[model samples]
Target: MFRQATRLLVRPISRTGSRRFSTDLPVAETADESFVEAWKKVIPNIEPPKTPLSFMQPRPATPSSIPSKLTVNFVLPYASELSKKEVDMIIIPATTGQMGVLPGHVATIAELKPGVISVHEGNEVTKYFISSGFAFIHANSIADVIAIEAVPLDQIDSSSVQKGLAEFTQKVSSASTDLEKAEAQIGMDVHSALNSALTG
Candidate 1:
């Protein structure tokens, strides 16, 4: 069966004498023109259509071309309005990860961790330590940071943070139940973040 299959695969194809593969055929007379000649005789020259004057005019500027400022509304609970102004950029410490938002950033809602939020404008940068909250970045260059508690970098006292860290650490170590340990750990984390923010 293998020999028979090989013989059939290697078989030479027979060609009929009527079939022609070369371009050496005799041309028809001028009166009996071929299809190509008939097409060339009728079509003649081909030219592209001229563009209109309106199409040549310059296009208008796009929305992205004109630089826009990001409007930031950094608010806190207890009627504390930290900032309600426009900034160039905002670096948020989101729970998933850190995110930098600009004017044309895509819309998103991120849960902020107990970390610092940096607001940049021109050559100056302002930073604030936030407890926790949500940040909403809109498509129209508007960012709203609603935090539970927010304090300016300069306003936070290093000594107070160190003391709180020590107390929280003690509480975490002495925690008896799981719930108590979790609460104490959360407090310690916040204090640790506060200490870092102050020193960093």
Candidate 2:
């Protein structure tokens, strides 16, 4: 029993497992210098691989004074819609509910669902329908939004959205398997959001 416990304790730590931590919040320590130094001593020819957190640029710290405008950076896979554009406010459809972000908002990372993101600039408001993605609100009046797929409000086809909603509604009822039902439900949810974005 003593020998088995010693073996378990002496086992090598997995580099893959060590890199699996969430990147939503800021990490105080980017790299373990002691571990790297040990690795260098063991294998002098090869350097240790850097993790994703190491490559990420450090964000600005929270400001003491609240700014008047909120800077937004909205990007998709293929295009960047808004890049450091200052806006009055942004209303995001978060899983918890509709979240309104203003200047100097507390730092938060939100998993976004299928819904309309309303970007308000004084009297003018621009809207976009996001399929799914995340929103990272920084403490220094900066909001970074990235989505899998995002379409402008006016660019979406309302008639096709209504048709898809009807199709998915029927699919949800007729689905035979659990996986099928879940997929159908997801389809229905997206269509529902699109329909609401158009009408609402």
Candidate 3:
């Protein structure tokens, strides 16, 4: 009679969802190594399309030029009735910073902060003030801006706008950092323009 010795081990899955290696021993002694190699080489047939996540969808190529159609939304009261013909691009006060969205932009959702929003169509520029909110932009030449509070330049009170500018100027003068000073200056300029638009 002859006696044989064998070793076996088991390993569990890893934290990253990968299987852990077990000790090098099989429960069955007659297992064929060549058969195991053949099985490893075989891959399950994938569907003609959408098999893998990467191949499930086709990616769009980058556009060479801006689209002809453009749409924009403003948070200011009565902004819905504003003319869309004079606006080609919008400058939004985003939470991270101001965002300039041009036509043919990819879809995106962003949080906005309280600051000035500007619109530029050709050489003409229009500005507005928006209190914190969110904005959404889509590839279909549409932009939506929703803010907690908004007042168009022409609708704001002149005295209040002047007061805001004066305060912004003082803040700019007292700012300790370049960033602070720059922000304050922008605020002052935006407020001034709002006042001009209102009182003019």
Candidate 4:
């Protein structure tokens, strides 16, 4: 039993040859260096690409930069007094159709019809009913409306418009000659438009 114990104690331990560790082994110290220095060593300095001269120039005036108010000149043959009135927008019943004009709009000339013209400034709107005219829109934010006949919308009487429309309609139906019928038809159209403007 003693001999067997001695043999077991003297036997060499078999190793799989993976790794071995000991407290007595020497360890090399790390060098003293900062992260910024390491980054600078890894990356080289490079200048950015040049930009074109046009890109550096001042930008041209845009639509939003233009003045929002429009100078209006509403006129009649007898009265050309409503001049240089600054308004935000103008809604006109043009011969082509109803059109809304704003600041910085392209220059145009439109013939007016018998309907309402709305002048807007901020939240408040002033309306006028015109018989016939022409409107000119300029590039300089100026608009001129030359009306043959114009009155405030509230000033128009509904009873008078109804009576006029009925009379013109009767004339249109009873006329004998073509010229008479044409004239009556025009009168009826104007009266009907006036009635609509008053009621609307």
In candidate 4, stretches whose alpha carbon ends up further than 4 angstroms from where it belongs are 1-65
Counting clashing residue pairs in each candidate, in order, gives 0, 0, 0, 0
lDDT of 4 by residue, 20-68 (tens): 2211122101111122233334442532222232134332223445586
Output the TM-score of candidate 4: 0.66
RMSD of each: 21.8, 6.5, 15.7, 30.5
* Cα error, candidate 2, residue 200 (Å): 2.2
Per-residue lDDT of candidate 2, residues 1-200 (tens digit): 33443344334544565542334343324234444555566656876656455676666767789999999999999999999999999999899999999998998999999999999999999999999999999989999999999988999988999999999999999999999999999999999999988998
lDDT per residue (tens digit) for residues 1-200 in model 3: 00111111112223467442222124122123323333334422421211133223332333567677567765445446244443688888787877998888787899976676778888877777766678888666677777776766556777887899899989999999999999998788677656654664
- Candidate 4 lDDT trough over 10 residues, lowest sum: 23-32
The ten-residue window of minimal lDDT in model 2 covers 21-30
Per-candidate Cα lDDT values, in order, are 0.73, 0.84, 0.62, 0.74
Off by over 4 Å in 1: 1-67, 80-84
Which candidate leads the pack in TM-score? 2
Q: Model 1, 66-128: lDDT tens per residue? A: 246888988877855545688889999999988999987876899999999999999999999
Count of backbone collisions within predicted model 3: 0
What TM-score do all the candidates reach, one by one? Answer: 0.65, 0.75, 0.45, 0.66
Candidate numbers, best lDDT first, in rank order:
2, 4, 1, 3
**Model 2 clash pairs?**
none
